[model samples]
Target: MRDRIEKRMAEIAVIGLGYIGLPTAIMFANAGFNVTGYEIRKDVVERINSGKAHIVEPDIDDLLRKVIESGKLRATSNPADIREKDVYIICVQTPLREDRTPNLTYLESAVETVAKAMKPGALIVIESTIPPLTTVRMAEFIEELTGLKPGRDFYMVHAPERVMPGRIFRELVYNSRILGGITPESAEIAERLYRSFVKGQVFRTKSTVSEVVKLMENTFRDVNIALANEFAYLAHQYGINVFEAIELANSHPRVKIHVPGIGVGGHCLPKDPHLLVWPARDDFGLIRLAREINDGMPLLAKDLLFEALRTINLPPEKAVVAVLGLAYKGDSDDTRNSPASAFVEAIVDDVAEVRTYDPFVEGTHGSLEEALRGADAVVIATDHTVFRSLDWETLGKLMRNRVLIDGRHVVEMPPEGFVFKGVGRGEY
Candidate 1:
């Protein structure tokens, strides 16, 4: 069945070639599908046409280059080329608004574009994460625009892209896939499209269930981190070691707690929580207390930093604060909704002369030594690997003071004068 479907879907049109889209396009092309990567950005379209990728994803550059060379992949700002493809995958952005509401503008626009050009019996897959109702509504819109009932004339499915930004290439083909279609036929077609390349299991369900599953996956991580962050705060107050506590707790068969940190950040984690909260209050007549708890974390980290400075008899505004790591996570340069960025920006705005160092971000500071120079205090907000490898003796010498706030519990200290603080590690 899968092989027969693969023979049917010879061409795939991937819309909105951002981080997820480009990589998906390349993966499909490498799997021998004729892949057309569509983007409205002229520069991006031209870059891919010239066998280059604008977005930074692992192995995508080489794969795109190869597939393009093999006449299996192409890119364009135009949709006429896109209309000819049998499979359409939407991978646009679904961000939160300034008011913290789920913003679906990019997604709606993608749907409008795809609806206008898609042919009969074509399979449409939405890989962008969205609120549960989004896929069903998009399917309705496609029916409305294409003048064809979803199950009969065309098929649509939601296979929310589960690929992490840094690990996109491997996860695209290796991680498990979910298929939620407007109809069972749509789901079956979507499953075949995925099975052509995906070695991972493709579970089948309805569109709304798949939508919530994607959001739930990210929200679960956010909620876990929130617990970790709260414990980190409590540990700071009690002078306990959180890393030790977490390690001890993990000894239990089912007590798998997350590591404490300054705050939770990243495009998905920060945004998905809000999506659930807004629809709960507005659409579903429910309150979002847990969401608020997680959302309050960045502020809590900031307030803790001020209290830490006070303990050392330093005014936060007067202290030269150094921030270690600006990316949301270690070993990657993506800063979209980075928790560290939020924390540092708050510190910069509220009360501090903040300097930041990230090995991934070149030219921000020539070296970690340069970023931490003359600091009255160092706030290890992001757990980049280089921060862990820092020579503590050299750090002590370079700093104007010795108060080290290990927001991520990544620092090792000297016994004499250094004080370290991490969530739940209430001892340092």
Candidate 2:
């Protein structure tokens, strides 16, 4: 089986062609495998077939075009197209429910689709971010659906994705991967498949550990960012700049501190902490606290905006505020659980009007001029590179009032004639 896969005879079907799935399918196809992308959205399927991507990521367009033009990759909404694939990889989402529990609805659906199509001796891999023991439970689920026992009749492995949005393509090749399988043989086979394209180390472990490792990586970042956010709050009370203090402290070799923003966002950071703590035996007090701190950042930003408004003697109903960015983080357009979205939700009803603009995000204002025109205040939600070098003088001229709120702390201080306030900076 390994030899056949290495020889490019194995057909790989990647289910759910969203952020992770699309790039992954493209990578495998570029590596000489016959790849089929299964998507529930017909528009996504059509776009990929037409060599266009539905999601925005850096350098994916040319890669998608090359893979499609090479005849190695195609997408379909029909499950029948994936019935005979040699390898089945489930890349669907595993988001949290409203109660902050692990939502396995999408994962279960993906498993059902694979169960209907998979044959004996076929390898099944899950690349979604799920809680510990989910891979084993999914393996049991496949057994109950198809009456095929894992490791004997079929293979199962958990290989959660570990790439950020903006650098997904590059990290997919270079990043070290964790492969946790139900059995040693399952791990070995999946390792061979990933080794084909992965330039970094492929570490093998039990399926549960791989799940925990993925959660741990994201949770660590979340906790650290939460600490930074707390520091920012403390700095505000002390009337100091948190960025300067963080830089000076981080100068020590071991004291690395993350930057505080309006809030933590994106699909992973905001939700993964909950996944880690939801199933744990203990209450996970620290983890819960960290989530709360990060979650409160949007409200903190709202307070800052209101304070700026009061300083200028403008009422909420009379303020025309412009929100700068909507995507969770910088450059790329992935807005899942975005802090900018929360900030907008928190203040949209109170403000006279809220205009939004993002350079890379669609359905926003056509130009910055439109969003900033006649606005009394502008909130820099996401730290997109374009937002860093804005001509504040010219843009401020277009606004009715000159108030700048830097939620991400990416903007410089005291725009010559404008009233400026940043997340961590005390006063200016």
Residue 245, candidate 2: Cα error in Å is: 0.3
Residue range 1-428, candidate 1, lDDT tens digits: 24536674467889998888888888888777888888989998889988888866667778888988998888888878888468889999899888888889999898888888887878889999888777888888888887878788888899988888778888888999889888898898788778778999889999988988888888788777777767776776777777888899999999999876767677788888667555554543222444555556667667767777888898887888777887877777777877777777777866658888877765467677886778887777777777777777777788887667776667655335655555455665
TM-score of 2: 0.98
On a 0 to 100 scale, what is the lDDT of residue 162 in model 2?
98
**lDDT by residue for model 2 over 139-165, one digit each (tens)?**
999999999999998889999899988
**In candidate 2, which residue pairs get closer than 3 Å at backbone N, Cα or C atoms, i.e. clash?**
none
Quickly count the clashes in candidate 2.
0
Could you tell me every candidate's TM-score relative to the true structure?
Answer: 0.92, 0.98
For model 1 the local lDDT of residue 243 reads 82
Highest TM-score, which number? 2
Worst 10 residues of 1 by lDDT: 281-290
